[model samples]
Target chain A: MNATLNKPTSSTDVAQNGANRVNYVTPLANILESKDGYVLEAEMPGVNKDGLEVIVENGELTIVGRRAVAENRGREVYRESRAFDYRRAFELDPSIDTTKITAKIDQGVLTLHLPKAEAVKPRKITVG
Target chain B: MSIIRYQFPQVPNWSSSDRLASLRDEVNRLFDFSWPSRDSGLFSGWSPALDVFDDKDNLVVKVELPGLNKDEINISLDKGVLTVSGERKQEHESKEGESFRSERYFGKFHRSVTLPATVDSTKVSASYKDGILTVDLPKAEEAKPKQIAVNVA
Candidate 1:
């Protein structure tokens, strides 16, 4: 069951140093599997539709959400949230149909529908 | 607990922010295990993360509440305390699909913070955008910083 599920790539790819270092938080995600394929939902609170990027390359599905930093309204008295972007990438499985994958962002949640390849989909066989 | 994605692998090289993030993750894990659930009327199963910014004229409070309709959220300021409460109801209840990994939280949440300075409650305004709710509390006339000149005798 775990092998069929996608795994996120290493976080080292986004880490950098000095002024170029872009800090990010991994958005909470949920993966649901049905007969057709998988549904992935990621929570990215501060990202708008324009700031989101969903790309499939090299057998990997990468999601990056760029959040606009709010202007300094006043001194920070109490803070639990940080000004970090959201980024996470998953290795695509061979059984998944890459071309049929569709994505949409509503509010701050990004939903990706990854359909199973036709060859891997379950089929009922009738005995002749 | 069986989810492998939650456990971030410890690598040799880590950026400063990554290290801090790991530390925070560890702290969150500690709290999650230590206090599984507390019987409190003011709080619920989960609370949205928030930030409070204090500026000269107005104090801004931002809360992260993704996938929630604005109508679901309720904000109020009473007696110098700002309270934010909301419910994140599950959108789908699949009868057949199996969940591989479920990490996002759902249900009612509550959080309240005391204001550092006096604010005009009547003039308080809130706006929601991109799943973030921002409440602006303008400082009262007496709360605003005033520079008084000293008269030399």
Candidate 2:
């Protein structure tokens, strides 16, 4: 059985850019394990592959992207509730092979496949 | 002489409307405090996922954005700052109550990144494949490392 828990904590200092005032709009991600590899899924609703970025630096994984506002409708709007600048980071495990990491984004869900190294894969022993 | 008595109404649990109202208030407060204080059009809430590493030629930025079409994303560079922005829409579904928890991000997002060094923006290229956006920022000619040769007598 695969069980995961959700935890929410305030991260105010992560992005300190001055003009953009939206807060508490952090991207949520989930990590899953499969027989072939570990998969990471992130929800990025309005972002496309062009705006999305994935990188590995110094044993850390980072994903960055932006959501552009639509053309003005020429109507006065009272309130808006959309988030931008989805940022998230993770510390990659040393056991995983960084070179073999593969990622894909579909339908606002980003999926990453981290295949296990040859030494970590399960091996079958034969008895004569 | 007359005696007067007043009975106070009991307070109820916060209704959905009340919760939504409070959420709106909180959002308003954020804007009130942040908008009037900055001079540079630099907005405060852009946070993009970034990974920095050394490559053979340049530093690459890969971002993940799903549910967005290729035409929606825009990339531009001005005065050494890279700006990426796009929008995503929500699908319409007739069915309701199907989701136990819904926290997926929706709407417009903007991210402006300041490069560590001057980049060769002319040679920069971006590609989107399989919902992943990859931006290759080539290092400037002068920024590339030079090797020196030494002769010993």
Candidate 3:
């Protein structure tokens, strides 16, 4: 389970060219466990490389994704909702090595690999 | 969209994390102020939020469905109603250790919207990119806006 964070998008400071648009959403995420470590995956559909931010500080991890605004065409008759920028965070455990964490964003899914600390990795045991 | 659990009428049990997420959703709703949220328990798993908007020439339908594969989705147009149905499989299970937090929703979901009769179903086209599915339905010739020249009457 990962903690859902309300932290603002760290990459928001990066200048973007848009008329006037400010929308946000909490991106959904999934955490899976593996032998070597854990994998954190978050779905941020509209975000690209330049509009994404991932940070880990003080045992907290935050993923921020800013969606590129689309150019207005004619009119909006009905609006279920806008695909807004997404943001979410998770608290990290002491057993996970933050420095070794790696991330890759592909097809809107951001996958972060958190390697286990040396002491937490499972070891094989042999008996005579 | 808030999942309306009929079984549990009152489950406001909010953790700090879940509270934050719901708060953001509230703020989003406050700014947009769109009516008729997807709070109805039409599906027990999850309901994807979608929009049906029209431009000068065509009507467009966009649905937000992240982490869902394109092949898993099915879109159909029958009469004047457009239906989008899909399944998001739960691909993992926890064997040990208590889950710290989890808010991700997964399972099969079906959503449909009735389109205007003006929509030309023959010219309907859909494309999925970045997890957002956009379906375009062109307007029929008769439904298009006509500009009439008015001389000194």
Candidate 4:
């Protein structure tokens, strides 16, 4: 796992943090590779922009989402949805450009754009 | 009660009972998953969770279904029982790249539950926002809880 990958790996690794009130599950995600960069999408329902956290630490990319269920504090006749927190992490290598990583969330879905480092990106070779 | 598959690889040719009649009593015990425990293996099956509750005025059900379109959701209430069903498609087509690790589930799913109070079928409405589907079932006049005033000396 230490070797640098030629293509970015799809981070199917999901993590769930210790929640004080309710339990949670890891959201589903899809990862795709493009010429310029790699894209990661995650499904995080009921989470707002303020509840999302994306961090890069020690070459690891971590995503955490916390959805507020304060409104659901009322009486409950039946409850099945975990209504808790979400977390996921991925290991990155030197080939990825961490500074330029961009992400957006729409309709409860999150998309992260991880660009490849300039040196490692494929370049077109011309005939001599 | 069972682990749902992400892909509809095959469809059963026949059904013994009415497609949803069995759902009548089984919905109550549908999602008793032992969450909060760490999942094993590289990829785990993904299934959206739901919650159903009621207040003084209305009964509500909320489902976590991110990346799903409004057209994909369907809700039906009959015989004091409510059903919410839908499908989430794999967002992308099968590409040529090798899958490092796959864990997301896609396919059809339906959740059914019988409600405690009789609801006004005509006044029911649902709204989807931030990937959560909220179905509001207004309680019938008799089903609504009445707050009685107390007279103090």
TM-score of chain B of each: 0.72, 0.63, 0.67, 0.65
Pick the winner on DockQ between candidates 1 and 4.
1
State the interface C-alpha RMSD of candidate 1: 5.8
Model 2 Cα displacement at B26 (Å)? 12
Model 4 native-contact share: 0.53
DockQ top scorer: 1
For candidate 1, list the clashing residue pairs, or say none: A74-B54, A74-B55, A75-B54
**Candidate 1 whole-model C-alpha lDDT, 0 to 1:** 0.79
C-alpha TM-scores of all predictions: 0.80, 0.42, 0.72, 0.72
User: What tens digits encode model 2's per-residue C-alpha lDDT throughout A15-101?
Assistant: 656976554335666565544456666776556677788988887777776664433322221112233467776776555688999
- Flag regions of model 4 displaced more than 4 Å: A1-24, B1-47, B146-153
Return the top candidate by TM-score: 1
lDDT per residue, candidate 1, B39-122, as tens digits?
332223565777788888888999988899989999988899999997889999867799887878878887788888999999
Evaluating just chain A, the predictions reach TM-scores of: 0.85, 0.74, 0.75, 0.77
Model 2 interface RMSD, in angstroms? 16.3
lDDT of 3 by residue, A1-128 (tens): 24232333442223344976554566666666665777777877766677789899888887789776765634655454544577766777677888999988765677788888888888888896
RMSD of each: 6.5, 20.3, 9.8, 9.8
DockQ of each: 0.45, 0.07, 0.31, 0.41
Steric clash pairs (candidate 4): A81-B50
- The C-alpha stretches of model 2 lying farther than 4 A from their native spots are A1-128, B1-48, B93-99, B151-153
Better of 1 and 3 by TM-score: 1
Interface RMSD of each: 5.8, 16.3, 7.3, 7.8
